[model samples]
Target: MNKAFKYSYVSDFLNLPEPYSEGELQKGLLRQMKDFILELGGDFLFIDQE
Candidate 1:
C-alpha cells in the first residue's frame, strides 16, 4: 500500500465512535493493540509481569 492509502485507512479507522469509560477505553486499546504497536515502528512492546 501507498502513503495515501495508509493515511486514509488510519483516518477512516479514527472516525469510529469514542469509548465511554475507562474499561471501554482499555477494551478499545486492546482491540487495536497489534496495529497500534506496528504503527509505532516497533518502539513499543507489551511485557507481562508474572
Candidate 2:
C-alpha cells in the first residue's frame, strides 16, 4: 500500500520570532497543544515524555 503521512507539522502558533532552534519550535507547538491537535485534524493526543 502506498500511503502518505505528515511526519512533521507546521502552524502559525509554532512560528517563533526568529533565530530559534528545533526545540523551540517543538515547545511552541506543545504550548498550543489543543490548537496543534486541531490543526492536525483533531486526531492527535499529547502523551507526556514521548
Clashing pairs in 1: none
What TM-score does candidate 1 get on C-alpha atoms? 0.32
Off by over 4 Å in 1: 1-19, 35-50
The window of 10 residues in a row where model 1 has the poorest summed lDDT is: 7-16
Model 2 score (lDDT): 0.67
Cα lDDT tens digits, model 2, 1-50, are 33454455455656687778888877786778755665787467656733
Q: What is the alpha-carbon lDDT of model 1 when measured against the actual structure?
A: 0.55
User: What does candidate 1's lDDT look like per residue over 1-50, in tens digits?
Assistant: 67767755232343346535656555556657756766887678755321
Score each candidate by Cα lDDT.
0.55, 0.67
Which pairs of residues collide in candidate 2? none
